[model samples]
Target: MRQSTTTIMDSQVNILKYNQYFLPVNLKVAKTATTLNAKGILPAGTIIDATGKVVNDGTAFGIVYENVDFNNSMGTENVSVLIFGFVDASKLPTAPADAAKAALNMIKFM
Candidate 1:
């Protein structure tokens, strides 16, 4: 018997109306080779690369709140985008060594 493998790729970003618990922060990001939009097409849960670019294959740093469009000048510019999203605590530079300890600290302090 022979077996085959399958791969799935998501190209569209989800645009949400509102998120009550979401705290969004803006980031200046550049376009990757695969990105189409000037604002960039980053789906929720997408990861950021070392150069501060959004890569589908990188380690996640945050979750996109909505489909964002940064280039309102109609492609006349290729400037870095100012996008916003919720930061992933686990990916934070100052994230605690212990998950439980982080959760406890969040509950007690924040």
Candidate 2:
């Protein structure tokens, strides 16, 4: 059986100045086997896996905007992520449109 976890990183902040076209979204991400630093930034252009977990090897869903990890425990945390429409092209040039569509669908259900 797979374990499902949700982690909250940061509260909503003003991102209008950065990308007027996109909105910042809060997502529940599962903690990986790797250790995460407290108040660590996930950086922009982070890819999210199909299960809604942030991963290095997965479809590009959104760009993280200096999100900080609040939970120090080896679990999940809620993090702020910016979707494709708002992310700069330089971030993920090869991001698939289908992936963005899929992410939007997932977010809608969430």
Candidate 3:
């Protein structure tokens, strides 16, 4: 018998530009391994769509508030969605598109 091990490194990106006051809503995120994050770590500022999957289209629901480790699990997990706040776009793993920006008007992408 053989055993294998995998270690995921910690995230160092600061996605939130300003969060002194913001609105958060609990939502279920899709557990699609490839879509969530290629490195298995979903960083903050990632735009979520109606299907709870990562979307770069014009339709955006909200922004992820903190780092979420999917651990390569194929199941949904409830995460905090920032409806209103300042997010640093440069810090995001995949910056949202203009349509996403328009959809998430409440969130200011700096």
lDDT of 1 at 10: 39
All candidates: TM-score: 0.34, 0.45, 0.76
> Which wins on lDDT, candidate 1 or candidate 2?
2
Writing each residue's lDDT as its tens digit, candidate 1 over 1-110 gives 54655334434443323333344455545443224343334444333433444543323333334443433323332322213323344432233234333322211112
The whole-model lDDT of each prediction reads: 0.36, 0.49, 0.75
Candidate 3 on 1-110: residue-level lDDT in tens? 54656676675566777757578888877776226556677677777876667788887888777777777445777778788878888887687889988999888878
lDDT digits (tens) for residues 1-110 of candidate 2: 55656676556433234444555677766666223444554434455554455544336455554544534534666666765344343444234355554654432211
Clashing pairs in 2: 7-76, 7-77, 7-78, 8-77, 8-78, 9-78
Candidate number achieving the greatest TM-score relative to the actual structure:
3
Most lDDT-accurate candidate: 3
CA deviation > 4 Å runs, candidate 3: 1-9, 72-74
What candidate 2 gets wrong by more than 4 Å, as runs, is 1-18, 33-41, 54-58, 70-74, 91-110
Ranking by TM-score: 3, 2, 1
The per-prediction tally of clashing pairs is 0, 6, 1
Model 1 segments more than 4 A misplaced: 1-18, 32-34, 37-40, 43-45, 49-52, 55-58, 70-110
Better of 2 and 3 by TM-score: 3
lDDT of prediction 1: 0.36
